[model samples]
Target: MNKKTLLFTALLVFGILQSGYTPPEEGMFPLSELHKLDLKKAGLKIDQKEIYNPNGTSLVDALVNVGGCTGSFISNEGLIITNHHCAFSAVQLASTPENDYLNKGLVAKSKEEEIEAKGLTCRITDSYEDVSNRVLGAVAQITDPSSRLQLINNTMKNIVNEAEQKDPTIKAEVSEMFIGKTYVLFRYKTILDVRLVYVPNRQIGEFGGETDNWVWPRHTGDFSFMRAYVSKDGKPTKYSKDNVPYTPKKFLKVNANGTDEEDFVFILGYPGRTFRHRPSEFITYQQKFVLPYTSELYDFQNQTMENAGKKDKRIEIKLATRIKRNANVMKNYRGKLQGLRGIDLIGQKKQEDAALAEFINNNVAEKAKYGNLMKDIDELYKVINGDANRDLWLSQIYNSTSLLAVSRNINNFKTALDAQPAAQKQGFFDQNINQVKQALSNSYSSFELDVDKTILKRMLNDAAAFSPQQKVNAVNKITSKGSNSAALIDQFIKHTFELSKLKNQDYVLNILLKNPKSISAYQDALLQLEQDLNKQIAALKPEKDRREGLLNKLMGDYVNVKEKFLKKDFIPDANSTLRLTYGYVRGYWPADATYMKPYTTIKGIIEKGATGNPDFGYPETIKTLWNAKDFGPFAKKDLNDVPVSFLYNMDTTGGNSGSPIMNANGELIGVNFDRAYGATINDYAWNESYSRSIGVDIRYVLWVATKIDKADFLIKEIGIKL
Candidate 1:
C-alpha cells in the first residue's frame, strides 16, 4: 500500500490491483505489468522475457516508431515492415510522373535503389525512468492552478532537455501515463534517415480503399517495407549516399505458418491515446461535439481533394495520400460516433460517476478531499463545450492542410519577431530563422493556391454562421447580416492570397533579415487577418489554461481517491508509450445472426475484385497467379490458399498501426493494421466482444513479395527462403 512508490514498481508488486483480479484487464498493459501475467497458461510457448527484457534488449528492440505509426525490424540489415499508409507519404514525396513509384510501387532490391523517405524518421525506445515525484514535487507549494501546471510543464521540459543534451542522436519525451498521477521519461534512439525499400502498387496496397477501411472480414494487403540507415561510422545522420543499413539488437523471425483459431497472440507497440479513465462529462462532450464535428470536417476536406484530383494523373497522385489520410480518419470518426451511441457511453459513465460520488460521501476524509471534484469537472467541461464550436472553426482556419495554414504559422512567427525589442530582435531572428524556413519547406512542398482559396473561403463561411453567442469577430467583419456571406469570404480570400508574401519564401526571408519594424510593416491582408482572429483566440486561452490547470490538479487527486474507493487501481490509459496487449485469435458475432470468421483469404480479394469497382480492382498479375495456383510454403493447407488477413481481439488504437502481431513463440504472424469498426469506441471503453483488430498475415506478405512482386532478395534477407 505504498502509494508514494514509483508507479511501475507499485503496479508490478500489486499485480493488477483488485483483490480478486490478479491479471491485468484486456487493455494495453505497460512493461512493468508484464511479469504478472501468466503467458505460459495463455498458450505462450516462449518465456515472457523474450518479448521485453528491461535490463537489456529483447523483442522490444526491434520495434520502431515510424513517424506516428509503429514498425518492426525483420532483417539483421534493418529491413523494417510497417503499414503501407504509414509509408504512403514518403512514396508520394518521392514519386514523379516519369518514374511514378507510388502507382507502380517501389521494389528496391539493392541498397543503392532505395529512395530516401523525405522527412520520415524512425525512433527506437532506448530506456525510460519514472519522474513523477520530481514533476509533482516542483508544483507542491504553488497554490495557483495555472502556476502549478506551468511549473509542472517546465519541470518535464527541463528533464527532457537535460536527458537529450547528453547525446545528439537521442531525444526524450515525458509522457503523462495517468494525467497528474504518473509520469515517465522515455528516451529514444533517433534515426533521422529512413528509406523506402519495398511497397506494392496502390491497387494492391490499398485494395479496398475507404469502402473496406476499419471493417472486419477484410482482405487488404496494407503492408510495406522500409530500411533504416546510419553513417558509415555507425552514427545517425541526415540522408546520405554513404550511409549503411542499421543492425538492430533484435529482429522478429517471420513465421508464415500463421495462427489457427483460438491460438494465443500478442502485440507490442506504441498505442497512441485512450480516454477510458475520463469522466462522464468528457464522454458527453466527445459524443455530442468532437466526433461529429471532426467527421464532417474531414469528409469535406476529402471531397475537396477528390474534386481537385479529378483533373489529371499527376494531381491524382499528389492528392492520393491526402485523400486516404482524411478519409481514413473521417470514416473512423463516424464509426466512433456510432459506437459511442451504441454503447450509451455517456449514460453508463454517469452511473459510475454517481457511484463514485456516493463512495466519496460515505467516507469522511474522502468526502472532504473530493466533495467538489465531480462538480468542478462538470463545470470545466461546460465552459469547454460552450466554446467548442468557436475554437473548432478557428482551429480549421488556422491549421488546415492548405498553404493558408502555412501563412498563419509564418504570420505568427513574424508577429512574434515584430514584438521583440529592437536590441533583442536580432538575436531572436538568428535563433528562429531556420524554424521559419523549415515550416515553409515542409508546407510549400505540397502547396496549392486554388485549394487554399477554396478551403479558406469555406472555413470563413462556416465561421460566419456561428451563433450570436459564439460569433467570430474577424469573420463577421467582412460580411453583413441578412446577406450571402459566400461572396464576401471569396473576395477576402482572393485579396489575402494576392497580397500574402508567404507565397514568396525568398522575399519573406529577406524581409525577416531587417528590423522588427520592417517585419511588422511588411504584413499583408493574410497576416492581418491571422492577427485579428488570434486576438480573439488568444483572449480565450487564459480561461482555458485556468480551467485545464485546475482539472489537472484535481484529476491527480481524484485518481487516488477513486483507486481507494474502487479497491483496485484501474489500468492506465494509453499515452503513446510502449505497451503489450494480448488476446486469442478468435472471431465474434459482429451482430445478430452474423458470425465473422477470424480469417480472410486471397479468394476474398479476387471475389471482391470481380465486382469491377475501382476499390476492389487489383493488378492482373494477382489473378493470373491465383488462376495458375502458383503458391509456396506460405499457403495454409486447410484454407487451400494464402491467408490475406485475420482479426484478433487485441486492444489497440491509431498508433498501433503497422505493429507486428506475434505468435506464442514470438514469431511474426502478421502486421497489425486496422481494427474492426465496432472497436472504434475503444478509446472511451473497450468491450471484449467488440474490440477486434485486423492484421495482414505474414504469409500473404511473403506471397506477394516473392510470387507477384518478385522480391526474392527480401525472402533471402529475412532468412525465410519462401
Candidate 2:
C-alpha cells in the first residue's frame, strides 16, 4: 500500500475508544426533532406537541423573522415584538430634526397615527420538509467535485422555482444541514406592510452603548414594538393606507411573572453562521490574519464617520445605520478573537481531530471512502490562505470609499456599452443609464470627501505595508508623483476628487445620457486605481479558485462520512435557518471564585442613572417612578423588585437578536438581545460552563409601555391586563 493507505488504516484501527456519547449536544437542532430531546428532564412543564406541531397552530405560528433578527406575534392584531436595535434603522429613517424619534421615544396614539416602515418585511415559516435523501441521491453519480456541486445547486434551484410557481406570494428556499449531508425545504409567508408601533429613546434602548454591549448583568431595555398590516382580504400587500391590521392565527401571551434561576427556557429564531466543526487549519488562519485585520478596518471606518458627522449633522442621520452595523461587527470580531484565545480554540480543535480520526477507525467502509478527507482539507488550507492577505486588502480598498465604488461602477457601464452590438447598444444604454444616475444621487447624499480621503490614505498605507513586493511596486508606481508618503497620498486623494465629474450627480447623469463612446468623457483617477487593483487580483485568481474548490469538496466528503458513522446525533451548523435551541435560565462566573447572578433589577438602573452621557442618562419619567417606589403589577413579588434583564445558557449568534425567549408553557418572558462576552465564542464552540445569552425581561417592556409611555390603547390591543 502507499503512504496515504497506511495513514487511513492507522486511523481506522484507533477509531473506537468508547461506545456512547456525552450529554447536552451543542447545536441549534431542527424543530421537527423536539420529541427526541429530553425537555421534561430539563424542567419543561409542557408537552412537546405544544411547542411544535406541523398540522396545527403552535408556537411556531407566532414566531417571525423580522428584518434579519427574530420576533413573534404578541397580539391577534399582528403586534410584533423584537429587539430595539433591530428596529433602530426604521426609527432613524422615520425621524427628523423636528421629530427626532430616536432621541425621544415613538408611540402611535391611534391606528391612524402609525407611520409606515419602508423596506421592512416579516417572514413566518409555513412548513418545512426533509429532502436529504432526494438531494444526495441526485448528486451521487457525479464524481468530479465542481460538477457534483453544480448538480446539487441546480437541483435545489429547480425545487424552489417549482414551489414558488404555485404561489406567487410565498417564498421558498432549500437550506442545507449537517454540512450538506442533509437538506430541508422551508416555505414562508411574507408580510410586506409593516409599521412602527413603539420604540424607546436611545437612552433606554441602547442604554450601555458600545461600552456595555455583549456583557452580562445588563440593564438595557432593548425591546421594541411593531405591527404588520395586510390587505383587507388578509393577504400580503405593499404599504397602503387602506390596509388593515393582520390577525395572525396564533400569538404568544406575555408572562409578566418572569423567570427564576434554572427555569426551563428556549429560543426560536433565524440564527446566522457558526463553524464549530471547521478544521483547525482554518481556525488558525482566522485567529492570525482575518479577525485582526477586519477589526482594525472597522475601527478606521467608524472613526472616519464619527469625525465627519461632527462637521455635518445631516450626514449623521444618513450614516447612523451604517455606523451601528459597522460598530456591532467591530466589537463582535474583537470579542470572538479574544474568546478564541481565551478558550484556546485551535488547540481544542486539534484534539477533536485526533478523536475523530479514532472514531473513523471503527467503520471500515468510512475508512476506505473518507480516509484522506481531513489530510486533503488541511493541505488545501495552506494553498488557499497564501493569497488571503492580497484579497482582503483589495476588498478593503473597494469598500472604504464611495468614489472608488462609483468609479468601478462607471467602468462596468463603459464595458457594457462596448460589449453590446451597435444595433442594441442604444437600448441597453437607455435601460441602465438611470440606475447609474440613481446610484450617484444616493452616494452623494452621505458623501464626505474629507472622510473618504482619510480612509483612503489609511487603506493605501496598510496595503503598501502588507502587500507582496511585486504588488508594492505597483502601488509605488502610482504614488511616485509626490515627494513623501503622506504628500503622495494627499496628492492622489486631491487629484481623484477634484478632476472627477462623478462628484456631481447631475453632471454624471447628463454625460451618461449623451452616451459617450470612450472612457475620456467620465474617466477619473479612481478608475486608474481600480484598473491596477483588478490586475493584481486577476493574477492571483487561478491558484485561489483551484485550492478553494478542493477544500470545499473535501469538507463535503468528511461531513458525509462522519454523519454516517458517528455515534452522536448530528446537528448541522447554522446557515441563517429557522432553528430551536432549549436551555435553562442561568448565570456563571466570569473568572475563578466570582459567581454572577442570572437576573438584574431596577436597582441596577438607579445605581447607573444620570451619568449625563446618552448611554446612562436615565429618563426623568422612569426616575420619578423609581423615586416614589411605585412598583407596578409588573414587579416580581418574590424578588421585591422589577426585573430588568436576565441571562440563559442557550446557543445563539448574531441573527438571533430580538428572538422571543419563552418559558415551558410557551409564554413570552423576554427578548433575546445580547450575549455575555465570554459566550461570543459560542459561535465556534459552546462552553456550557461559561457561555450565556442575555435578554431584556418582558415585565420591563410592559412597564415602559403602560406607565412610562402611557400607551394604554397599545397595551389594551395586546391584552396585557396591567
Q: Write model 1 residue lDDT over 1-722, tens digit each, in one string.
A: 12332453354335535334333346798886778778776667887888889887799999999989999999999899999989999999899888898878999989999999987999999988999999988988897888888888899999999999986668899999888778899999989899999999888888998889989778888999999999999888999999999999999999878887767799999999999988899888888888888888878877777787787777777777777887888888899988988888899989988999999888889889888888888888888888889877877675564566665677777778878887898899779877777876777665666766777777888888888889898888888653778887877778778877677766765664355566656756776677778789788877767877888987887778878978987778998889899887867888898888888888898999889788898988888888888878877886798899998888999899999999999999999999999998888888777889999998998999998899999889998854
Off by over 4 Å in 1: 1-24, 167-169, 419-432, 480-484, 498-521
- How does residue 347 of candidate 1 score in lDDT? 91
> Candidate 2: where are CA atoms >4 Å away?
1-23, 141-144, 358-364, 408-410, 422-446, 469-477, 480-486, 505-521, 531-545, 561-566, 610-614
Tell me the tens digit of each residue's lDDT in model 2 across 643-715: 8899888999988999999998888999999999888887788978888999999988888888788888877
Per-model TM values vs. the true structure: 0.93, 0.90
Model 1: number of backbone collisions: 0
Q: Please list the Cα RMSD from the true structure of every candidate, rounded to 1 decimal place.
A: 6.2, 8.0
**Candidate 1 clashing pairs, residues 3+ apart or interchain:** none
